[model samples]
Target chain A: MRVSVIATAGNIAGEALSNKSVVMFDILRASSTISTALANGCKEVIPVIDVEDAFALARQLPEGSFILGGERGAIKVTGFHLGNSPLEYTASVVKDKTVIISTTNGTKAIRYAAGENGRVFIGSLLNCSSVAKALADLSKDIVLVCAGTRGKFSLEDTLAAGLVIKDLLKFFNKNPWQAKTQEHNKFYLEETPIFNNDALILEDAAVAALRLAEYYWQSPIQGLLDSLHGQKLLQLGLAADLDYCSKLNHLTNVPVFFNDKIL
Target chain B: MRVSVIATAGNIAGEALSNKSVVMFDILRASSTISTALANGCKEVIPVIDVEDAFALARQLPEGSFILGGERGAIKVTGFHLGNSPLEYTASVVKDKTVIISTTNGTKAIRYAAGENGRVFIGSLLNCSSVAKALADLSKDIVLVCAGTRGKFSLEDTLAAGLVIKDLLKFFNKNPWQAKTQEHNKFYLEETPIFNNDALILEDAAVAALRLAEYYWQSPIQGLLDSLHGQKLLQLGLAADLDYCSKLNHLTNVPVFFNDKIL
Candidate 1:
């Protein structure tokens, strides 16, 4: 299995993720909210690219059966039933409802990754371990796609990717599997049991993500709080959302977005 | 002064580099070649977007007085006077002659940054400190643009940007200049003499670049030799170019690409 990471959706080529198991991360709220909403019993999430798409999709569903939810520029889109806050996605509000989401960055990333063949799993700190385990079980090369803010890098998404890659590395290292010699030799892990047991190739970005995760291992929450995106969220009075998204392994469900709906 | 780094030229928006002092880094060769050519007494270099542009520009110049040079896929373009290898731009061939270049990445970046107000300078390890000192003298907010290989991140260009930022930080710290409070506070340099002397702010990418530079400070040459781009160049029998580009402070000239020519 080869693991690679794309820092932002804009970095993704049209056919890069085809046939690869992809874990999409937008931890600053999209992934977190999706994971929370599904865990809270929301039926499914329909990610849309723009406010018009959300309204168009919601209009087709029966009134009150679906909710318009998302943010533009970090604030609730005008007339949206709920903002992109995970805490707002409670059982009472989103239960048994379909959420039509149109956020500034996250939904665009989902659309970008939905280009062709591949299972797109929404990941955040809430389901970091669960998503990692799922990827390991699939036993295919994986690409962690970060939904960076706009066309720029976002620290929160990258760190979330790091956390996922780190967890996946641990899972594969602990489980016995067939090893490929060239990949093992590149990492110089000849003596490591995991390398002997399984063949795993980590691209440079994946290795960098692991190193980044280790750098912030002592205080991942603080790392998020200190990020440029996190600071913007805090200024927008979304400190609670920031805190919620920082919790590692807080949820067990891995929300997979397939066929235009996150299940 | 605010310092920001763009990991790749593709990430730059049309207006992102407008009105900013842009330092373009293509450490694997283009920037290095331009800087070395100018230092070796080449009259000037015209950076164009395509081979046709190079030919068009050359036709307007005096016959036999200009040279068309550059690479298409790391190999010399057909019927060109020279390839992108800095060594090919020696004193005997390039000195006192106008050279038009169109490479895979660097020239595109120069054109991208040339959109509006602001000066563009070519940078590499050969003239890293020289470029940093020039920026300090300009006393303006700086944007370091890395001309990544293709549209993806090239480790060598990024690390070279890091080296330039590191040098600029040192220049500000060592010399007395007016300091901006917010920039100083963010860096937590409140008690430092440089903070008192000058105001400078680093964007997230700049901070990341500094950290990356520090991580590889011990052996920068090896870092370049091991980069994905460097490896590709080495495979193409361009080890000499890699070795030349890896040398720090070897040249004192700061080649500024202004008015469509590197002078």
Candidate 2:
């Protein structure tokens, strides 16, 4: 399909991005943590834009079913059950719990993209393969929405998206037969220069992407607290959830949003 | 020197531009045209934000001595002296005249950076070497302000900034500078990776910048009308003066802006 990448949310909110299958990415922590929690065994990850909403959601959850997670500039929120570190999201800690996530950049991006018509998959390098596979199965036009820091593009986020684009290209090549056998291969691939780079054979490029992916797959949320931007969050005392956000496949399911709410 | 880049005016106002050595680039035309106009032998180029203000300035100027020029979306403004095209701004047409100029993105950027302190120079690849030398001589904190199309960072502006950064690194290598330059010297040089990359070396970069500079350097007012953003100004029917902007010299002159005026 026609896959247009808006470098920043601000670029589209007031200008373009309408009726697109938006894939929102905040690679440093938010998206990675969400993917990890869901994969490990978390029930649902509810992303809130503000701290008040996060606490409100945690309070309303059925007692032990929910865990408060997320960061404010990388530090854990006060009185919260966890911080933003993905390492803390272990099988023992979050085996079957709902997660309340709130961060400065990621949630706001989700809120913004929620206005569009197509499916919004929480994307990151950790879940790049699965997300791409899901998109291929759904086979619809996709937009890799990068949740840039504030209103600007971030190097980390853009690179992560490059990974997603890279993966989708690979998926298309490996599954030439899946389309003939399955019913979900209806989406058309849009030719773009961003897809031409041959990073698969390059040792450094492959290692870098895989390392970044593996690092976040388990301790995804924790990765955010350590980043240049994440440190700012930690200094702000939003560190509790940092540990909890690091686990991979903690929830074992992905959270999809459409029109601003969980779908 | 610290380099701050503002993607658009929508993110901040003139106050945000206040107190910095700003290099404003609306590369599609304003900076290019302004640089071009000065290079081609124009009087001082006056940049006005509003179209009505440009018209008012035009009406007040002495007749036959001035020309009104600018554009709106690649088209000429009605009731104006000329359209926004570098090819049209020849010295024969613009010599010894006061021209009222206006444009969409470029002039707005000029207004924004002009409101700040320190130096404010219109930048584009046409004057890449000149802009770099000027910034290096000043050696103060610098801000690369891109007058993004509408309010988003287009591919054109960032690449242009990378070009300026590329030149600064080269200039640094030749200069017998003092200590404490290591950190910034590397940073200034690092941006060159994108500029020097084989993938981006195209005539569009230099030609676009040169066209803008030539347009602005010619009939100072007509040059101002040569930006894509300038076209937006023309469409609104705002025309400005050319007599105020001066000619461009081979030895780059650092336009110092203090007290709301470029020196």
Please report the candidate that would top lDDT against the real structure.
1
lDDT of 1 by residue, A1-263 (tens): 87778888877886888778998898988999999999999999999987997898888999999989999889999999999999999999999999889898999898786668645899888888898899989988888898887676666777778788778877755321122212322222112323222467665455445545655555566556546677677667666777778888899999888888999
Model 1 lDDT per residue over B98-160, tens place = 989889988988877665764688888888789889988888888999887777666677777
The superposed Cα distance between candidate 1 and the true structure at residue A225, in angstroms, equals: 3.9
**Chain B vs. true chain B: TM-score per candidate:** 0.88, 0.66
Which number leads on TM-score? 1
Two-chain DockQ for each candidate model = 0.10, 0.04
Which docking class does model 2 fall in? incorrect
Model 2 CA deviation exceeding 4 Å by range:
A1-18, A116-119, A129-143, A150-152, A166-227, A230-255, A258-263, B48-56, B116-119, B169-263
| Root-mean-square deviation of every model | 6.5, 11.8
| Predicted complex 1: DockQ | 0.10
